[model samples]
Each structure stands twice: as structure tokens, then as C-alpha cells.
Target: METMRLSSSFTKYSSLSSYSSFSSSSSALLQTKSKNFISLKSVFPANSIPNGNRNLTIVSASKADDGPQQQQHSPFWGGESFFRSVLASMESVYLNKNPTAKAILERVHSVDNNQICYDHLAFRTFGVNGHGIGSMANFFLDFGYTQREELRFPEKKLKALWFSPPSLPVSDGGSGVNGPLPRIFISELLVDQMSPQAQEIIRKCTEISGSGNKHAALASALGSLTWEKPLYSEFQQLARESEYAAWTLVNGYAVNHVTISTHHLKSQLGNIKSVNQFIEESGFKLNSEGGVLKVSPDGMLLQSSTVADSVSFCFSDGITESVPCSYIEFAERLILPQFKNLPEKEVREFHRRDGFEVGSADKIFESTSKEQLTRRA
Candidate 1:
């Protein structure tokens, strides 16, 4: 529950996952965000992380004159972990292309790799309890090309690698708790020398010969590689297809993360407005309306309204047995609808007559996605 996990938050939820046909978009978004989070794994010496092309690594900041301030307020917190995740991911991509030619490399090939990546993070999520994030996001940081590329490594010459999150907060009063350790870690082993067949495959894959230009693809694929979590494109496609209304998409990459983190912000998400209003839950936002809000169907009181609050009621005219919150935790939960349908105009008229302002003639269920995006620009 975004509101509960963060306690202090929630954002708007425009619709439900099953509002339309069930789509794979939710899974895609989960996977994509997980991929971005894994991007921050770093091999740099001691607490350093990359910010874009610069060595904005944590070590450099720590070495800076800030002293205790830096120690007390380490950069890795909440969603800002996305930045760290991005750095980790970049290193992974770099390794993907420059696999020590002869130094050997490792790989991951299926659900098997999932376990390895999980080991790297040492983090576990049992369900989609946070917004839609939970267990699906448990191993995001060690996934992607690092684990995936292991499948493409030179046969017989494969490397054995294991990793875990170096970022977990230090335990309070542990056995000889050492100095702050990294959340980025990877253990490696070299396999037999590259096979001639494997070498040839690499040559073919990296070929720059006439009619075979793979460098461009490689460059495009690896360029600006990051671990920062992202909203998957499949999620977008699904949202478009779902009956759920939306407000706007968030572009967390551009924001000053040291102040506000993408993950921290995203943590505020709820299934939809009706579930709960947790802002940082999903980075989703509305116009001037406190970003987004969800009101209980029975919670509304037409009799309690005046021509004053500039509010109105639009009834779906169905009995809604909605669960308290639809965060992934309650996956098996269902709500039975029990009401009659009414025309949009009649619902609007009743609401206006009650006392609230009806949105424009075009908007339905009071969604302001267009307005929010337009104003965001």
C-alpha cells in the first residue's frame, strides 16, 4: 500500500488493472522498472557513483569537505537509489560490450538467472504490495544485460559471477560492523579460454563490414545505459488500452534527484484514485487538485452538498464492494459490482444540480490527463 508503506503518502489512481482486458503491460512495467534499478551497480572503488558522464561517484562527494554532513546523509535513499541503480547498470552495459576479450565472463539464461540476481540484491518482495511494485521488483538491479548477457558469453569460456546489493543500510550495532560498505557487489570467475566458435560469433556480432553494421546497434543499445527505474513502454500501451483514466506520465530523469528521488516519488502510487491517494507512490500526478485523489463511493454525500463547493456527482450506479487497497498484496481480492448504469449527461446534470461543477463536456469521470500534461510543459 503506497499510503501505508510510505505512511506519509499516495497519488491518484485513474483506473483499475482489470478495468479492461488483462494486459501484460503491468508485468512489463514491473520488469522495466526493475531493469532500471539494476543499472546502478558499480565497480568503482569505495562509495563512488556516476552522474551522467562525470565521476559524480559517492566517493568523490564523500572526499569533498562536507565531512559529517556527507556521512550522515549518504546519497542513496528511497527512489534516489535509481541513480545509484543507473550507475550500476552503466557498468554492467560497459561489461556487456568490453568483456575483457580474454579475461572470461559469466551469464544467466532463464528463471535460473533470476535467483542469481536476487542473490545480488539480497532483497525480496513477496507480492505487489507497494503500488504495483512488491515482489516483482525485488531483484530489479541485477537483471538486464548483466544477467542476460551471461547467456551470450563464450561457451566453455563462461565466467562465474555472483553479486548482491552493497547498498543495504548498515545494521545498527552488528558483529564488528565494518565501515559503511557498498550496496554494489559482484563476484566473478573466468571460464575456459574463448572457444573459436564463440570468438567467431563475437566477430560477427561486432562486425563493421559492408552490409553488416552492428556497431550502430551496439552503440544505440549501450549508450546512456542507466539503472534508474523507468515506466515500461508496455505499461503505457496497457494504460491506453485500459478503461482506467490517467493524469500524466512522470519524467523523473530530469529532476534533481539529490532532493527528490524517482523511486521515493514513485513509491506513493495506488492502484487508482479510489484505492487511496499516495503521491510519491507512482510519480503520477494531477493538475492543481493535490495531484490526485480517490473518494469512497459511499463516502460521497450529495445531501451534504450545497450549490457552494462547486462539486457534483456522477454515478456509475453500481454496488461497489471495492477492497480497501489494491496494492499487489491483495491479488486474489475481487469487488462485485451492484448498480445500474446511467447516461453520462444525466450523471452530470445530477451532480451540477447537487452543487459541484461538472468538468467540461468532453471529460469523463473527471480525468485531467490532457490538462496536466499540457500544463506540465
Candidate 2:
């Protein structure tokens, strides 16, 4: 086994209180009118049709074997093309709502003209009335993504799964103009495990305005809350039991966080620690719950995220309050031991650590927690 190591200087700096806190009141919410239903026509523009039949290879690491395996997929069609639009819309919605993320992307662009590559796009949902991972997974599954391992967070009453994307050539089906496509990480609150009172609050909201399986993905792509505006009291009640539930109550099916793959950055920012330092130096605060750098027990996967921004939400009672909104995340998947001997140029997505870590992700989930959100204030 390879020894886990990180820069001593980076570790020391990460432990210090160097980030500046911003007043949440100064941040304005990018509010949109609630839509009863999001039409597919709105998501799929006329020009968004498939240009050509493109064959792609899907890669998956076999748990029963040492080396990675590849499977040939059929020619690309409307699914892959439509997924691109979905991603574009989700990113647009996220950037429009998250100024902090927009500024960070601008900074990256200023440094290098290269487009940012995503590690994964995360979504949070409630597990009730056909509104959980199954609703969201179908969209990605239709796009040639494969379901991977399941991760559970007993303490948070949450369960999540990460999906691997079909690897296509740069011009064909990757995330941006270059690099590999990002994985999808969707987590749902374990509603049944919550207190009866909290469960009732969630049940009422979903029952009143839940988007059935048919339109769940559309609602997510539009970044629309499928449910009616939640009451402040209900939000508080859920927050006391499970902060995850409270977050989903207001920001239903919205992109929870878009993770930047630091290793793919191929620059000084490629190092996870260096990227965290740059983010803090650039004036954004990171989630410091388990320190800025969250590492897996084996240390191959390292992650960090900005403290979630505050959004001005109008409650059901017509009272507006600043609540936690989505934020940005950074991840660095280190090269596996077997791949360490290979030339740097030969390393591919499979060469590095894949999937997610429960321990690291558990902390990453706290990006939107009140404790982390308080840092923004």
C-alpha cells in the first residue's frame, strides 16, 4: 500500500483561521418565479438535436479485480445530447444563484483560458412520494451513466449514490470543451428515520406539491422547487432534526454543489491543498467543520468546499429570511498505487481514485449546514 502524505505547510495553513468572513446580509438572492411545471420544450431547445452518431466507451473498476474494465456502448443519441443541455441548464442556474462560484470561475478563467472540468454534480432530495434518487437517477441512466456503490450517513439520515459517466472523446461527450465527463452524486434524506413530527412536516410539503417521477428531472433542470414555499416554522422544525431535510425543503432538486476536479486542473491549482489555499486567499470561506481538507481514511480522495451562500427565501407566511443555499466544491483524486509508476502523461481518470468517500462526503455535506453557513455571516 502507498503511504498517505500531504504538504506539511498546507496542513498547517489549513488549520489556521485565515479566511475572512463575509456578512450574509450583503448577499442578495437570485430569486425566480415558481413554475407549476417545467415543460420539456424549455429544457430542450430546437438546436439541441444530436449532430451525429458518436460511439463512446464506458469504464468501470471491477471490485472483484485489480485492473479497470471498459465496456462498449451503443452510438450516442438524444439521451447524451439532452444530458448536455441538462448540465448546461443546471450550471447556468447554479452560477446565476451562486455569485461566489461565479467569481471563483472568473478567477480561474483569468489565470488560465481553459474551461473548468467538473468532478461531479450533486443533488439533495427527500425520500418520499417518489421523489428521491430514483427520480434523479433515471435522467443520468438514460444518458449512459452507471450506478455505483451506495453510501449512507446514519447520523444525517441520508443515503447517496454516485454514477459514473460514459467516457467520450473531448469533442463528443465530456463535461466541457475538454476533459472527462463528470459523475453524478445524488443523495436523499432517509425520511422514515426522522422523528414523526419532522417526517410529517416533510410529508406535507411533498404531498402538497411534489413533482411525480414523470417531471422530477425537468424540475431539477429548471432549478425549480417542486414543492410550495415551505413555512419558516416547518423549516426550523426540520432543521432541528435533520438540517439536510430543511435544505431540501427550500431548494428542491436544485444542484446542491458543483465540484471542480482539481487533479484535472494540471496546474498549481491541481493540488487539492493548493486549490484550497487559493480559494481562501481569493476571499471565499471554506467549510471548516473537519478542517478545510477532507480526506478519505486511505487519503487517495481529498475534498473541500466553500461555505454555502445565504439566500433570501420567502416563506409560506410571506416572511423573507436568509437561508443556506448551494455552494461550490473542489476535489482531488490522487493516483492509485499501481498507476504511480506510469508516466504522468499516461494517467487517465481510471488511473486516479474514483467514486466518493463517506467520511469525506459526510463533511462535504456540511457545506450547507447552519454551522458552516454561520461562517458566511
Model 2 root mean square deviation, Cα atoms:
14.7
Off by over 4 Å in 1: 1-136, 140-287, 291-368
lDDT of each: 0.20, 0.67
RMSD for all candidates, in order, please. 26.2, 14.7
Colliding pairs, model 2: none
Give the CA lDDT, 0 to 100, for residue 289 in model 2. 79
lDDT tens readout by residue for model 2, 225-280: 76789889999998898888888999888889888888777567768798888888
Tens-digit lDDT string for candidate 1 (188-247): 111113234432322332232222121111222233211122223422332343212111
Model 1 scores what on Cα lDDT? 0.20
Model 2, residue 271: distance off in Å is 1.0
Error of 2 at 223 (Å): 1.9
Span of 10 residues, lowest total lDDT, candidate 2: 1-10
Candidate 1 local Cα displacement, residue 152, angstroms:
40
lDDT of 1 at 279: 26
